[model samples]
Target: MPVGAQLLEGGRIRFRLWAPLAERVEVSLEEPGGTVHLPMEAREAGWYELSTDRARVGDLYRYRIDGVGEFPDPASRYNPLGVHGPSQLLDPGQFVWNDRNWRGRPWEEAVLYELHVGAFTPQGTFAAVRGRLDYLRELGVTAIQLLPVAAFAGAHNWGYDGVLPFAPAASYGHPDELKDLIQTAHHKGLMVLLDLACHYFGPEGNYLHLYAPAFFATDATGLAGRSIDAANPVVREFIIHNALYWLAEFHFDGLRLNAALLQEQAGQPDLLEALAHAVREGPGRERHCHLLLGHDRRAARYIHWHDHSVPRRYEAVWNDTAQQAVQEVLIGAGVAAVDRPLERLGACLSRGITAGGPDSLLPSAFVTFLQDHACIGNRALGERLHQLVSPRPLGAMVATTLLAPMPPALFMGEEFAATQPFLYFCDFNPDLIKKIAINRRKSFAHLPGFRTPKARARIPDPTHPATFARCQLDWNSVNHSPHADWLDFYRRLLAVRHRQITTRLAGMHEEAVQFTLPGEHGLSIRWTLGDDSVLTLLGNYGDLPLAGLQRPEGVVLWAEPGEAEHALNQGQLPPWSVVWLLRAAG
Candidate 1:
């Protein structure tokens, strides 16, 4: 049954809930003087509903289970106070929308920029992000993928700890303000992809256990207390409806499902498949709704298992293998360690996979990035790419990612080389705060630096307010010398990608792309499009210039460290540098 407080005609609000455990459910509306309890009629399939004209928009309400304690609506659209407070009635159709004619871009053209609403700006609201839409548009990103904005317990969090899936986080802004951001982004030719975590619910303010125990399955090993029961029909419907609500109501272009592999159910309809089907058959089908699954290499094969005869199952999956391999080569044994850097990096560039390729999947099905939120935030020490590697190597890695064949995503501050660290932070209560801090320290106990008691004490507490404040991007830093130069470098690289590379790779056979190691520490990649045009990339990872390498005959599009003229004149590529060349004819 459809859940939550649905507004009908003539200022009437229909409150419906699925409470199988309760004999009677009543709607408690907060009035001017006190609270008013309205009796609800029980329906089939363990559902209860009530219609009242007095409960209009802006009214605060909750559910009384079997005349017991009151709790916030599980399907709340707005929580004015916080996740634990009363649910406010909101009419989705009331807000004026301007993105009617905005159809999203193709998957191949996507250059994703991931950000958290709180850390994105000092203001930490959806309204604040609207001021930077033009900046992102000028930066040449086609899409902005935001972390979860659902209502949670306290004032600050990474958004993964959301308890109310339907309600936008009150700390971010008003519900209408979120719509304003999405509409504004669409007008600027930027698509919005909301990050959603449906595998498990957060511990704080989680009211599901109070009403619906069947919603979750017992899994002691799961990250959260328990995993969602994907096999349950009610749970499945709730998940599917939430996906549609975001697309149909908020006008978001797509969704990036976090920990997609965890939602798998055996001998039952897959949640991802049902989601893709719902989007394709729904009213937003014309918008080309892209579904990107965040899965590791172990689940890459499942992405291709869906029938190709149907509409495309997913646009792409986050290429963690490629990210880890590249990070190994650049950072080596720094903050986070990686072994076999050369071999892993070589395999990633050669076959589009670090370990092995799923034969049926297309090259575009994988999304690669030089740095991502998890790679920087979840580390033992939260460090940016600039802190991990020198300028030249960082430049080479950034260039390689942008010019790669697969879609590429960028963390918020990477383009300008912002020095702020993106550490993992949450705003749980004091009781859970100490436990979370201890567990976080234990997570990195294997590392030599974090193994000591004194060293472990230096680690930032996830519940500290200062920790969340430190992650905010410093927009002023872009005005400095190297930061300004790096920003320009990203602009040029993305320009070349959007203009020259993306169109050329369309329909090209896999055999046309080739990768070769120029030296023990350098790589060379060349590919020919169907139009006979050739694109080649050369990089030097060592401290010395790579010599005696065959150079492709074409115009030099870009070079690292402003050394294009020097490298093109002399056949030797400089140390820790990369160059992109294009030939009109093979």
Candidate 2:
């Protein structure tokens, strides 16, 4: 709304652009008759705006900066012709919203399932995703979190190389189709979250340097591209407004601000705080607009909990530290190395997984997962956790995270034990593609088998159509042998989670948790929930059966062994097995 084309009350369209250094800016409207170029009047703060009856919704237009050349609107609502093409005038009010009554669910009830739209279904469209809503709902997830859908360069991407922040990717269906999907998802009692590349715009389609160099200022991030100038008020407003647009216009239940922690490292804390304040004052007042940061422990200050046992700023943080520890415990010093993995995992499950200090937040403040896009896709072969670890150990780790006090997320097809590799596929130019492949191989070259160039060559080429296709979920596999059982396993855990643990997640005091190692490779952990219910998780992370553990007293929520009581009472747990229990507060 701050910098895009807005449809006014009288059928006139208002075009606005911030080209601080440009001497002149013109709105090039694609009329049926011919191209109509109108010079915009310069306003304060280097803003150029125009209101014209000639420009209407559905018309394609571009801004011509200083008569040098035409470029797509930076805040385009719909880039139907791709990032290099013109921006379509989309009227936000055109779509009839049916989700007015949907106020959104609490963060405590969140069981996030992260999926990329392009690889979610065969159709790879918003409508196709809508078709899978019932499956997701039945899968027992409380919410669905989509990877970035903003318009990017070619046909396929992991959704991170986004350039047009405002436009939904044309590959994922029309803007209205996405809105329809969100509305439908809300109707199905599922919350929808959009992951945003808030830290920086993608390299290829971005043209901000040409007209507005002030938009980018910092270089503190480890990302390949330059960072957004969070110090600039206008730049801050652009990003904050973009955040608001998705929440207010598209009706997303929440937003995961990707790479936002890097901003704090850049010493631009003002932007994040200002944005949080803006969201809370704006759309957050009307609904449960959960704000999640994609930072690890480094951004602890932003997620620090208040006396009310909730975050002082954002709702939650993506617990990369916890996930790493989980990986370390399951495949200790194997593919990914970490020292004292069981201790690491114990710390994560109890208190210090996130820096383990006085400033450490509540367990519920962390969103834990074993596999996400970055974890699996970044690998040379994109091998999932199932491929690396045995089924039993994998299941134990999954159960531990899902049943833990922290909210849990499942990467797309992880619930079904999907073999499909969530590969790092992108659509950049030939040079950039080569660069990406080289960079990827370089990152993995230090690994055990990938030291040789030949070994590295085995890594799938991201630009290849086959590589991208291989990432697609095999829907039929879910009903087959192990996959069906895996699906059932997830459903059982999630059903127990929302029914027992999730409802009592509030007031989860960080100090109320207890952790102890039952055997050489067993975890014994318990948490006193808000309602004083004692939630417990007992598991064996080793290949051998863990023996001589006291059986926790409570109702069984979920257990790997069929005869759970028999095994627990015997004071032993089978190899790579876990059990969840809930003791009613007396």
Highest lDDT scorer:
2
Cα RMSDs, all models: 2.6, 2.2
Q: Give the Cα error of residue 102 in candidate 2, in Å.
A: 0.5
Query: What are the models' TM-scores?
Result: 0.94, 0.95
lDDT of 2 by residue, 153-247 (tens): 89989887788889999989899999999999999999999998866777678876678878887443223656687778888889899999999
Task: Candidate 2: list runs displaced more than 4 Å.
Answer: 218-223, 259-269, 307-311, 334-336, 356-360
Model 2 steric clash pairs: 352-356
How does residue 366 of candidate 1 score in lDDT? 76
Residue range with the least summed lDDT across 10 consecutive positions in model 2: 218-227
- Give the Cα-based TM-score of candidate 2 against the true structure: 0.95
lDDT by residue for model 1 over 552-574, one digit each (tens)? 78887778767753774677888
> Distance from true position, residue 409, model 2, in Å?
0.3
What do the candidate models score in CA lDDT, each in turn? 0.81, 0.84
